[model samples]
Target: MKKILIFFLFFAVLGSGCAQHNAESIYDKDEDRAGTDINRENDGVRRGNGNQDNGMTMTDQNPNLLNTDNQNRHSFSMDVQKAKDVISDAGYEPGSIWINGGEMNVTARLQGLVTRKDREDAQKILQNRLSKALPRYDVKVNIE
Candidate 1:
């Protein structure tokens, strides 16, 4: 009876430790999986800054769809195309105009150097123009 009790207790302790280890391993795996997601989210911001931090950037991770060359390749909504035309009519060389998820993104070359306030004014003007045209669409402008 004593031997049996000791054996059962030994197994109970061993089994508890194993269970603890199993739980830890599962938690580690979840963390590891989420680790990539966290890094990817940060990467989006870092990369969007045009890799200004001097970090190595991967072109494939983020494509340069803001180029004027590919504008015809992708099918755009009527509002996006209309905004592009408006930008062109405004005498600005538009880079790319894309609309997705009720948002519009515009990249264009504006007058004045990068240091001037005109760049920001240009962005705002373009943003407001699109906003007036597509009231419900979120507009974002980028200068090249």
Candidate 2:
């Protein structure tokens, strides 16, 4: 009886995750395209009044658009903050960051006359730190 009660309590807590998720669920349209060309015009046949008694109405957000081929791969991430913290901790500061998909493009600059070796070292450190934190991301570190 004690084992069954514990299992029920665990299940209840796990079920509460849906309510605890605070982030907005936005769909990645680019990642939705899976190589195969889909003609949106011929996606579905709609009857009058937008009511489908025999079928389901198709929107831009189709459940099939999700990556069913590879469940492990995700299109979105929050690695920009990690890269910022990494560079800041290394004593090199980054300007505005522009992120495109999984790629992070950052530019760092130092005032006054600076040696080429100093710039190179800063770039290397940023690349290494970001790569280690986000292995799948393409890090572009530019120092000026």
Top lDDT: which candidate number?
A: 1
Query: Please, what are the lDDT tens digits per residue for candidate 1 over residues 3-107?
Result: 999999999999998887556554344235546533235546422225464652343234443334433433345677788787887778888877676678889
Candidates in order have lDDT scores of 0.69, 0.66
Which residue segments of model 2 deviate by more than 4 Å? 1-77
Task: Compute the lDDT for candidate 1.
Answer: 0.69
- The list of candidate 1 runs beyond 4 A from truth reads 1-76, 111-114
Pairs clashing in candidate 2? none
CA shift at 123, candidate 1, in angstroms? 1.0
- For candidate 2, write residues 17-106 as lDDT tens digits: 866675543342222346432323245443323444445323223533444454444334345666677778777766766777667787
Q: Identify the leading candidate in terms of TM-score.
A: 2
Candidate 1 clash total? 0
